[model samples]
Target: MPIKTPSELFIHDLSDTYSAEKQMTRSLPRLARAATDPQLAQAFEDHLEETRAQVERIEEIAEALGLKLKRIKCEGMAGLVEETLSMVDQVQEGPVLDAALIGSAQKAEHYEIASYTSLILMAMKLGYAPAVPLLQATLAEEQATDKRLGAMAEASAIEQAEATS
Candidate 1:
Protein backbone atom coordinates (compact mmCIF):
# COMPACT_ATOMS: atom_id res chain seq x y z
CA MET A 1 0.00 0.00 0.00
CA PRO A 2 2.79 2.34 -0.87
CA ILE A 3 1.22 5.39 -2.48
CA LYS A 4 3.65 6.15 -5.26
CA THR A 5 1.12 7.19 -7.87
CA PRO A 6 -2.28 8.82 -8.12
CA SER A 7 -3.83 5.53 -9.21
CA GLU A 8 -2.51 3.83 -6.13
CA LEU A 9 -3.95 6.56 -3.95
CA PHE A 10 -7.30 6.28 -5.70
CA ILE A 11 -7.50 2.56 -5.07
CA HIS A 12 -6.63 3.01 -1.44
CA ASP A 13 -9.33 5.62 -1.05
CA LEU A 14 -11.81 3.39 -2.85
CA SER A 15 -11.12 0.59 -0.42
CA ASP A 16 -11.46 2.89 2.55
CA THR A 17 -14.75 4.28 1.36
CA TYR A 18 -16.04 0.80 0.58
CA SER A 19 -15.30 -0.23 4.14
CA ALA A 20 -16.93 2.90 5.53
CA GLU A 21 -20.10 2.38 3.51
CA LYS A 22 -20.28 -1.25 4.53
CA GLN A 23 -19.97 -0.26 8.17
CA MET A 24 -22.67 2.37 7.75
CA THR A 25 -25.08 -0.13 6.25
CA ARG A 26 -24.71 -2.27 9.34
CA SER A 27 -24.77 0.56 11.88
CA LEU A 28 -27.59 2.63 10.41
CA PRO A 29 -30.27 0.27 11.63
CA ARG A 30 -29.24 0.87 15.20
CA LEU A 31 -29.37 4.58 14.55
CA ALA A 32 -32.85 4.27 13.09
CA ARG A 33 -34.06 2.31 16.07
CA ALA A 34 -32.55 4.77 18.51
CA ALA A 35 -34.10 7.78 16.84
CA THR A 36 -37.14 9.19 18.57
CA ASP A 37 -38.17 11.22 15.58
CA PRO A 38 -39.97 9.12 13.02
CA GLN A 39 -38.59 11.20 10.17
CA LEU A 40 -35.06 10.83 11.45
CA ALA A 41 -35.50 7.10 11.75
CA GLN A 42 -36.85 6.92 8.23
CA ALA A 43 -33.92 8.96 6.98
CA PHE A 44 -31.44 6.53 8.54
CA GLU A 45 -33.30 3.60 7.01
CA ASP A 46 -33.31 5.25 3.62
CA HIS A 47 -29.59 5.99 3.88
CA LEU A 48 -28.95 2.37 4.72
CA GLU A 49 -30.39 1.46 1.34
CA GLU A 50 -28.36 4.17 -0.30
CA THR A 51 -25.20 2.94 1.39
CA ARG A 52 -25.86 -0.53 -0.01
CA ALA A 53 -26.14 0.92 -3.48
CA GLN A 54 -22.95 2.86 -2.95
CA VAL A 55 -21.23 -0.38 -2.07
CA GLU A 56 -22.49 -1.93 -5.30
CA ARG A 57 -21.26 1.03 -7.27
CA ILE A 58 -17.82 0.70 -5.74
CA GLU A 59 -17.81 -3.01 -6.52
CA GLU A 60 -18.69 -2.19 -10.09
CA ILE A 61 -15.74 0.16 -10.28
CA ALA A 62 -13.43 -2.58 -9.06
CA GLU A 63 -14.91 -5.07 -11.50
CA ALA A 64 -14.36 -2.71 -14.38
CA LEU A 65 -10.77 -2.29 -13.37
CA GLY A 66 -10.28 -6.09 -13.20
CA LEU A 67 -9.32 -5.73 -9.55
CA LYS A 68 -10.78 -7.42 -6.56
CA LEU A 69 -12.33 -4.95 -4.17
CA LYS A 70 -10.20 -5.06 -1.08
CA ARG A 71 -11.37 -3.36 2.06
CA ILE A 72 -8.91 -1.50 4.22
CA LYS A 73 -10.32 -1.16 7.70
CA CYS A 74 -11.59 2.41 7.96
CA GLU A 75 -10.54 3.37 11.43
CA GLY A 76 -12.08 6.84 11.16
CA MET A 77 -15.54 5.52 10.47
CA ALA A 78 -15.14 2.92 13.17
CA GLY A 79 -14.40 5.59 15.71
CA LEU A 80 -17.38 7.68 14.63
CA VAL A 81 -19.77 4.74 14.75
CA GLU A 82 -18.40 3.68 18.11
CA GLU A 83 -18.94 7.14 19.56
CA THR A 84 -22.48 7.23 18.22
CA LEU A 85 -23.20 3.85 19.71
CA SER A 86 -21.84 5.00 23.03
CA MET A 87 -24.08 8.06 22.91
CA VAL A 88 -27.07 5.86 22.19
CA ASP A 89 -26.41 3.70 25.24
CA GLN A 90 -25.56 6.54 27.61
CA VAL A 91 -28.05 9.22 26.60
CA GLN A 92 -31.75 9.27 27.39
CA GLU A 93 -33.84 8.18 24.41
CA GLY A 94 -35.62 11.32 23.29
CA PRO A 95 -35.10 14.43 21.20
CA VAL A 96 -31.67 14.77 22.77
CA LEU A 97 -30.78 11.38 21.48
CA ASP A 98 -32.23 12.27 18.10
CA ALA A 99 -30.13 15.41 17.99
CA ALA A 100 -27.03 13.50 18.95
CA LEU A 101 -27.78 11.01 16.21
CA ILE A 102 -28.04 13.79 13.67
CA GLY A 103 -24.75 15.21 14.87
CA SER A 104 -23.01 11.87 14.65
CA ALA A 105 -24.50 11.10 11.27
CA GLN A 106 -23.44 14.48 9.98
CA LYS A 107 -19.90 13.78 11.13
CA ALA A 108 -19.99 10.59 9.15
CA GLU A 109 -21.25 12.42 6.09
CA HIS A 110 -18.54 15.03 6.38
CA TYR A 111 -15.89 12.35 6.57
CA GLU A 112 -17.34 10.76 3.47
CA ILE A 113 -17.44 14.07 1.68
CA ALA A 114 -13.76 14.71 2.37
CA SER A 115 -12.78 11.16 1.46
CA TYR A 116 -14.72 11.14 -1.81
CA THR A 117 -13.50 14.56 -2.80
CA SER A 118 -9.90 13.39 -2.54
CA LEU A 119 -10.72 10.14 -4.34
CA ILE A 120 -12.43 11.97 -7.17
CA LEU A 121 -9.43 14.19 -7.63
CA MET A 122 -7.11 11.24 -7.61
CA ALA A 123 -9.27 9.36 -10.08
CA MET A 124 -9.32 12.30 -12.43
CA LYS A 125 -5.61 12.81 -12.09
CA LEU A 126 -4.93 9.17 -12.86
CA GLY A 127 -7.25 9.28 -15.90
CA TYR A 128 -9.68 6.88 -14.23
CA ALA A 129 -12.48 7.95 -16.53
CA PRO A 130 -15.17 5.49 -15.44
CA ALA A 131 -14.46 5.86 -11.77
CA VAL A 132 -14.85 9.61 -11.84
CA PRO A 133 -18.58 9.49 -12.43
CA LEU A 134 -19.20 6.68 -9.98
CA LEU A 135 -17.26 8.42 -7.25
CA GLN A 136 -18.97 11.70 -8.08
CA ALA A 137 -22.36 10.10 -7.77
CA THR A 138 -21.53 8.80 -4.31
CA LEU A 139 -20.06 12.12 -3.28
CA ALA A 140 -23.23 13.91 -4.35
CA GLU A 141 -25.33 11.52 -2.33
CA GLU A 142 -23.18 12.09 0.72
CA GLN A 143 -23.51 15.84 0.33
CA ALA A 144 -27.27 15.58 -0.03
CA THR A 145 -27.51 13.39 3.04
CA ASP A 146 -25.52 15.91 5.01
CA LYS A 147 -27.80 18.70 3.89
CA ARG A 148 -30.87 16.72 4.84
CA LEU A 149 -29.48 16.08 8.29
CA GLY A 150 -28.66 19.73 8.71
CA ALA A 151 -32.20 20.69 7.75
CA MET A 152 -33.65 18.22 10.21
CA ALA A 153 -31.40 19.53 12.94
CA GLU A 154 -32.32 23.13 12.20
CA ALA A 155 -36.04 22.60 11.75
CA SER A 156 -36.75 20.17 14.54
CA ALA A 157 -34.18 17.90 16.14
CA ILE A 158 -32.10 20.55 17.85
CA GLU A 159 -35.00 22.73 18.89
CA GLN A 160 -36.97 19.81 20.22
CA ALA A 161 -34.00 18.53 22.08
CA GLU A 162 -33.46 21.94 23.66
CA ALA A 163 -37.09 22.28 24.58
CA THR A 164 -37.05 18.91 26.26
CA SER A 165 -34.08 19.96 28.30
Candidate 2:
Protein backbone atom coordinates (compact mmCIF):
# COMPACT_ATOMS: atom_id res chain seq x y z
CA MET A 1 0.00 0.00 0.00
CA PRO A 2 1.23 3.45 -0.85
CA ILE A 3 1.71 5.52 2.27
CA LYS A 4 -0.85 8.27 1.89
CA THR A 5 -0.62 9.73 5.38
CA PRO A 6 1.65 10.04 8.37
CA SER A 7 -0.26 7.21 10.03
CA GLU A 8 0.48 4.91 7.13
CA LEU A 9 4.09 5.86 7.25
CA PHE A 10 4.19 5.07 10.95
CA ILE A 11 2.70 1.66 10.31
CA HIS A 12 5.17 1.03 7.53
CA ASP A 13 8.08 1.85 9.82
CA LEU A 14 6.61 -0.26 12.61
CA SER A 15 6.24 -3.22 10.29
CA ASP A 16 9.81 -2.81 9.16
CA THR A 17 10.96 -2.94 12.78
CA TYR A 18 8.82 -6.01 13.38
CA SER A 19 10.49 -7.72 10.47
CA ALA A 20 13.90 -6.73 11.77
CA GLU A 21 13.17 -8.17 15.21
CA LYS A 22 12.01 -11.43 13.68
CA GLN A 23 15.18 -11.67 11.67
CA MET A 24 17.26 -11.03 14.76
CA THR A 25 15.51 -13.84 16.59
CA ARG A 26 16.57 -16.22 13.84
CA SER A 27 20.15 -14.97 13.57
CA LEU A 28 21.06 -14.35 17.21
CA PRO A 29 21.26 -18.01 18.15
CA ARG A 30 23.88 -18.62 15.53
CA LEU A 31 25.80 -15.66 16.81
CA ALA A 32 25.61 -16.97 20.34
CA ARG A 33 26.92 -20.33 19.30
CA ALA A 34 29.72 -18.86 17.24
CA ALA A 35 30.96 -16.59 19.98
CA THR A 36 33.93 -18.11 21.78
CA ASP A 37 33.86 -15.73 24.71
CA PRO A 38 31.50 -17.07 27.29
CA GLN A 39 30.35 -13.61 28.31
CA LEU A 40 29.78 -12.60 24.70
CA ALA A 41 27.85 -15.76 24.03
CA GLN A 42 25.69 -15.16 27.06
CA ALA A 43 25.09 -11.58 25.99
CA PHE A 44 23.71 -12.89 22.71
CA GLU A 45 21.51 -15.28 24.59
CA ASP A 46 20.28 -12.53 26.87
CA HIS A 47 19.50 -10.24 23.96
CA LEU A 48 17.53 -13.00 22.29
CA GLU A 49 15.10 -12.98 25.18
CA GLU A 50 14.91 -9.19 25.08
CA THR A 51 14.25 -9.32 21.38
CA ARG A 52 11.33 -11.66 21.95
CA ALA A 53 9.81 -9.20 24.42
CA GLN A 54 10.42 -6.39 21.96
CA VAL A 55 8.39 -8.30 19.38
CA GLU A 56 5.53 -8.61 21.82
CA ARG A 57 5.67 -4.91 22.54
CA ILE A 58 5.38 -4.13 18.85
CA GLU A 59 2.38 -6.42 18.62
CA GLU A 60 0.76 -4.61 21.48
CA ILE A 61 1.32 -1.31 19.73
CA ALA A 62 -0.19 -2.64 16.52
CA GLU A 63 -3.25 -3.95 18.33
CA ALA A 64 -3.68 -0.71 20.21
CA LEU A 65 -3.41 1.30 17.00
CA GLY A 66 -5.91 -1.00 15.23
CA LEU A 67 -3.29 -1.60 12.59
CA LYS A 68 -2.17 -4.94 11.33
CA LEU A 69 1.50 -5.05 10.75
CA LYS A 70 2.44 -5.74 7.16
CA ARG A 71 4.13 -8.97 6.26
CA ILE A 72 7.15 -7.11 5.01
CA LYS A 73 10.79 -7.98 4.88
CA CYS A 74 13.20 -5.50 6.45
CA GLU A 75 15.87 -5.55 3.80
CA GLY A 76 18.18 -3.45 5.91
CA MET A 77 18.29 -6.04 8.66
CA ALA A 78 18.54 -8.85 6.13
CA GLY A 79 21.60 -7.25 4.62
CA LEU A 80 23.20 -6.85 8.03
CA VAL A 81 22.52 -10.48 8.91
CA GLU A 82 23.87 -11.69 5.59
CA GLU A 83 26.97 -9.59 5.90
CA THR A 84 27.62 -10.82 9.45
CA LEU A 85 27.15 -14.46 8.51
CA SER A 86 29.38 -14.05 5.50
CA MET A 87 32.03 -12.48 7.68
CA VAL A 88 31.67 -15.34 10.11
CA ASP A 89 32.32 -17.80 7.32
CA GLN A 90 35.44 -15.98 6.22
CA VAL A 91 36.99 -15.57 9.68
CA GLN A 92 38.50 -18.37 11.69
CA GLU A 93 36.54 -19.05 14.85
CA GLY A 94 38.15 -17.67 18.01
CA PRO A 95 38.91 -14.24 19.36
CA VAL A 96 39.01 -12.80 15.86
CA LEU A 97 35.63 -14.25 15.09
CA ASP A 98 34.33 -12.97 18.40
CA ALA A 99 35.57 -9.52 17.50
CA ALA A 100 33.86 -9.76 14.16
CA LEU A 101 30.66 -10.91 15.84
CA ILE A 102 30.77 -7.94 18.21
CA GLY A 103 31.26 -5.63 15.28
CA SER A 104 28.30 -7.19 13.47
CA ALA A 105 26.14 -7.11 16.58
CA GLN A 106 27.02 -3.44 17.19
CA LYS A 107 26.06 -2.68 13.61
CA ALA A 108 22.72 -4.31 14.23
CA GLU A 109 22.24 -2.44 17.50
CA HIS A 110 23.01 0.86 15.82
CA TYR A 111 20.51 0.07 13.10
CA GLU A 112 17.89 -0.77 15.69
CA ILE A 113 18.65 2.40 17.64
CA ALA A 114 18.05 4.52 14.56
CA SER A 115 14.91 2.61 13.65
CA TYR A 116 13.45 2.91 17.14
CA THR A 117 14.28 6.61 17.35
CA SER A 118 12.35 7.22 14.16
CA LEU A 119 9.53 5.05 15.39
CA ILE A 120 9.20 6.96 18.64
CA LEU A 121 9.19 10.29 16.86
CA MET A 122 6.64 9.04 14.35
CA ALA A 123 4.47 7.58 17.08
CA MET A 124 4.45 10.82 18.99
CA LYS A 125 3.67 12.83 15.89
CA LEU A 126 0.90 10.46 14.80
CA GLY A 127 -0.70 10.64 18.25
CA TYR A 128 0.26 7.08 18.99
CA ALA A 129 0.85 7.86 22.64
CA PRO A 130 0.67 4.24 23.70
CA ALA A 131 3.32 3.27 21.19
CA VAL A 132 5.76 5.93 22.29
CA PRO A 133 6.57 4.21 25.56
CA LEU A 134 6.85 0.83 23.93
CA LEU A 135 9.13 2.20 21.29
CA GLN A 136 11.16 4.04 23.90
CA ALA A 137 11.58 0.91 25.96
CA THR A 138 12.89 -0.97 22.97
CA LEU A 139 15.17 1.91 22.11
CA ALA A 140 16.65 1.79 25.58
CA GLU A 141 17.29 -1.91 25.25
CA GLU A 142 19.04 -1.39 21.94
CA GLN A 143 21.17 1.35 23.37
CA ALA A 144 22.10 -0.75 26.38
CA THR A 145 22.96 -3.66 24.17
CA ASP A 146 25.18 -1.45 22.07
CA LYS A 147 26.94 -0.21 25.17
CA ARG A 148 27.47 -3.75 26.44
CA LEU A 149 28.88 -4.84 23.10
CA GLY A 150 31.21 -1.88 23.05
CA ALA A 151 32.43 -2.62 26.54
CA MET A 152 33.01 -6.26 25.66
CA ALA A 153 34.95 -5.26 22.59
CA GLU A 154 37.13 -2.98 24.63
CA ALA A 155 37.57 -5.37 27.54
CA SER A 156 38.50 -8.38 25.49
CA ALA A 157 37.38 -9.12 21.94
CA ILE A 158 39.39 -6.45 20.18
CA GLU A 159 42.36 -6.78 22.46
CA GLN A 160 42.42 -10.54 22.08
CA ALA A 161 42.15 -10.30 18.34
CA GLU A 162 44.94 -7.77 18.25
CA ALA A 163 47.18 -9.95 20.38
CA THR A 164 46.55 -12.89 18.10
CA SER A 165 47.40 -10.87 15.04
Candidate 3:
Protein backbone atom coordinates (compact mmCIF):
# COMPACT_ATOMS: atom_id res chain seq x y z
CA MET A 1 0.00 0.00 0.00
CA PRO A 2 1.22 3.51 -0.67
CA ILE A 3 1.97 5.64 2.39
CA LYS A 4 0.18 8.95 2.80
CA THR A 5 2.09 12.14 3.62
CA PRO A 6 0.93 14.33 6.50
CA SER A 7 -0.71 16.72 4.04
CA GLU A 8 -2.32 13.84 2.21
CA LEU A 9 -3.64 12.56 5.51
CA PHE A 10 -5.16 15.96 6.21
CA ILE A 11 -6.93 16.09 2.89
CA HIS A 12 -8.02 12.50 3.36
CA ASP A 13 -9.57 13.44 6.66
CA LEU A 14 -11.61 16.13 4.96
CA SER A 15 -12.62 13.70 2.29
CA ASP A 16 -13.62 11.13 4.87
CA THR A 17 -15.85 13.60 6.66
CA TYR A 18 -17.45 14.70 3.44
CA SER A 19 -18.23 11.10 2.57
CA ALA A 20 -19.62 10.44 6.04
CA GLU A 21 -21.86 13.49 6.01
CA LYS A 22 -23.17 12.72 2.54
CA GLN A 23 -24.02 9.18 3.61
CA MET A 24 -25.53 10.47 6.85
CA THR A 25 -27.99 12.66 4.99
CA ARG A 26 -29.48 9.45 3.68
CA SER A 27 -29.26 7.66 7.03
CA LEU A 28 -30.84 10.28 9.30
CA PRO A 29 -34.37 9.84 8.08
CA ARG A 30 -34.15 6.11 8.68
CA LEU A 31 -32.88 6.82 12.17
CA ALA A 32 -35.71 9.22 12.83
CA ARG A 33 -38.21 6.67 11.70
CA ALA A 34 -36.63 3.98 13.83
CA ALA A 35 -36.80 6.20 16.91
CA THR A 36 -40.01 5.66 18.81
CA ASP A 37 -39.57 8.74 20.94
CA PRO A 38 -40.63 12.09 19.54
CA GLN A 39 -37.65 13.95 20.98
CA LEU A 40 -35.27 11.43 19.48
CA ALA A 41 -36.97 11.71 16.13
CA GLN A 42 -36.85 15.50 16.20
CA ALA A 43 -33.19 15.46 17.13
CA PHE A 44 -32.39 13.34 14.10
CA GLU A 45 -34.37 15.68 11.87
CA ASP A 46 -32.63 18.79 13.23
CA HIS A 47 -29.23 17.22 12.82
CA LEU A 48 -30.08 16.23 9.26
CA GLU A 49 -30.48 19.90 8.45
CA GLU A 50 -27.36 20.79 10.36
CA THR A 51 -25.36 18.05 8.65
CA ARG A 52 -26.33 19.36 5.22
CA ALA A 53 -25.10 22.81 6.13
CA GLN A 54 -21.91 21.35 7.50
CA VAL A 55 -21.28 19.59 4.18
CA GLU A 56 -21.72 22.90 2.39
CA ARG A 57 -19.28 24.64 4.71
CA ILE A 58 -16.72 21.95 4.19
CA GLU A 59 -17.13 22.25 0.44
CA GLU A 60 -16.60 26.00 0.72
CA ILE A 61 -13.47 25.46 2.76
CA ALA A 62 -12.16 22.94 0.25
CA GLU A 63 -12.71 25.45 -2.54
CA ALA A 64 -10.99 28.27 -0.65
CA LEU A 65 -7.98 26.07 -0.10
CA GLY A 66 -7.89 25.16 -3.79
CA LEU A 67 -8.75 21.58 -3.02
CA LYS A 68 -11.52 19.59 -4.57
CA LEU A 69 -13.82 17.75 -2.18
CA LYS A 70 -13.52 13.99 -2.45
CA ARG A 71 -14.56 10.88 -0.61
CA ILE A 72 -12.36 8.48 1.31
CA LYS A 73 -15.31 6.14 1.92
CA CYS A 74 -15.62 6.59 5.68
CA GLU A 75 -16.00 2.96 6.64
CA GLY A 76 -16.21 3.91 10.29
CA MET A 77 -19.40 5.88 9.82
CA ALA A 78 -20.89 3.21 7.61
CA GLY A 79 -20.29 0.56 10.24
CA LEU A 80 -21.57 2.69 13.07
CA VAL A 81 -24.78 3.53 11.29
CA GLU A 82 -25.26 -0.05 10.27
CA GLU A 83 -24.82 -1.24 13.84
CA THR A 84 -27.22 1.39 15.13
CA LEU A 85 -29.81 0.25 12.65
CA SER A 86 -29.43 -3.38 13.68
CA MET A 87 -29.65 -2.48 17.37
CA VAL A 88 -32.74 -0.38 16.85
CA ASP A 89 -34.32 -3.14 14.82
CA GLN A 90 -34.54 -5.39 17.84
CA VAL A 91 -35.80 -2.72 20.20
CA GLN A 92 -39.42 -3.06 21.19
CA GLU A 93 -41.58 0.02 21.51
CA GLY A 94 -40.73 1.35 25.01
CA PRO A 95 -38.29 3.47 27.00
CA VAL A 96 -35.52 0.90 26.92
CA LEU A 97 -35.50 0.98 23.15
CA ASP A 98 -35.57 4.75 23.09
CA ALA A 99 -32.68 4.86 25.53
CA ALA A 100 -30.71 2.33 23.55
CA LEU A 101 -31.35 4.21 20.34
CA ILE A 102 -30.25 7.48 21.92
CA GLY A 103 -27.08 5.87 23.16
CA SER A 104 -26.28 4.56 19.72
CA ALA A 105 -26.91 7.96 18.17
CA GLN A 106 -24.71 9.70 20.73
CA LYS A 107 -21.93 7.24 20.06
CA ALA A 108 -22.08 8.18 16.40
CA GLU A 109 -21.94 11.90 17.21
CA HIS A 110 -18.90 11.46 19.41
CA TYR A 111 -17.11 9.82 16.50
CA GLU A 112 -17.92 12.79 14.30
CA ILE A 113 -16.74 15.19 17.01
CA ALA A 114 -13.34 13.52 17.16
CA SER A 115 -12.99 13.39 13.39
CA TYR A 116 -13.80 17.10 12.96
CA THR A 117 -11.48 18.17 15.77
CA SER A 118 -8.52 16.49 14.12
CA LEU A 119 -9.49 17.86 10.71
CA ILE A 120 -9.71 21.42 12.06
CA LEU A 121 -6.22 21.19 13.52
CA MET A 122 -4.91 19.86 10.23
CA ALA A 123 -6.57 22.67 8.27
CA MET A 124 -4.98 25.26 10.52
CA LYS A 125 -1.57 23.62 10.26
CA LEU A 126 -1.88 23.62 6.48
CA GLY A 127 -2.46 27.41 6.41
CA TYR A 128 -6.14 27.22 5.73
CA ALA A 129 -7.48 29.95 8.02
CA PRO A 130 -10.67 30.30 6.03
CA ALA A 131 -11.22 26.59 6.51
CA VAL A 132 -10.99 27.06 10.26
CA PRO A 133 -14.35 28.71 10.83
CA LEU A 134 -16.05 26.33 8.47
CA LEU A 135 -14.57 23.47 10.45
CA GLN A 136 -15.57 25.25 13.65
CA ALA A 137 -19.12 25.62 12.41
CA THR A 138 -19.36 21.91 11.68
CA LEU A 139 -17.70 21.10 15.00
CA ALA A 140 -20.18 23.23 16.91
CA GLU A 141 -23.12 21.62 15.23
CA GLU A 142 -21.76 18.15 15.91
CA GLN A 143 -21.22 19.10 19.55
CA ALA A 144 -24.68 20.57 19.83
CA THR A 145 -26.20 17.49 18.28
CA ASP A 146 -24.26 15.27 20.64
CA LYS A 147 -25.33 17.35 23.63
CA ARG A 148 -28.93 17.20 22.54
CA LEU A 149 -28.71 13.42 22.23
CA GLY A 150 -27.24 13.20 25.72
CA ALA A 151 -30.10 15.25 27.14
CA MET A 152 -32.62 13.08 25.40
CA ALA A 153 -30.97 9.94 26.67
CA GLU A 154 -31.01 11.28 30.22
CA ALA A 155 -34.60 12.41 30.25
CA SER A 156 -36.22 9.67 28.20
CA ALA A 157 -34.05 6.57 28.25
CA ILE A 158 -34.44 5.53 31.84
CA GLU A 159 -37.90 6.90 32.29
CA GLN A 160 -39.08 5.15 29.18
CA ALA A 161 -37.34 1.99 30.26
CA GLU A 162 -39.06 2.09 33.63
CA ALA A 163 -42.42 2.77 32.09
CA THR A 164 -42.02 -0.10 29.67
CA SER A 165 -41.05 -2.38 32.51
Candidate number of the best lDDT: 2
- Model 1 poorest ten-residue lDDT run: 1-10
Compared with the true structure, what per-residue lDDT tens digits does model 2 show for residues 1-165? 578998888889999999999999999999999999999999999999999999999999999989999999999999999999998899999999999999999999999999999999988887899999999999999999999999999998988998998
Residue 128 shift from truth in candidate 3, angstroms: 0.9
Error of 1 at 118 (Å): 0.8
Ranking by TM-score: 2, 1, 3
Candidate number that wins on TM-score, 1 or 3:
1
> How many clashes in each candidate?
0, 0, 2
lDDT of 3 by residue, 1-165 (tens): 353787778777888998889888988998888777788888889999998998888788788888865547999999988988888788786677778778888888898999999998987888879889888888998998888888877776778688778
The C-alpha TM-scores of every prediction are 0.96, 0.98, 0.93
Candidate 1 per-residue C-alpha lDDT over 44-135 given as tens digits, one digit per residue, 9 for 90 to 100: 99999999999999999888876666658999999999999999999999999999999999999999999999988887887778888999
Local accuracy by lDDT, each model = 0.92, 0.96, 0.84
Pairing residues by index, what is the TM-score of model 1? 0.96
Off by over 4 Å in 3: 1-3
**All models, RMSD in angstroms:** 1.0, 0.6, 1.4
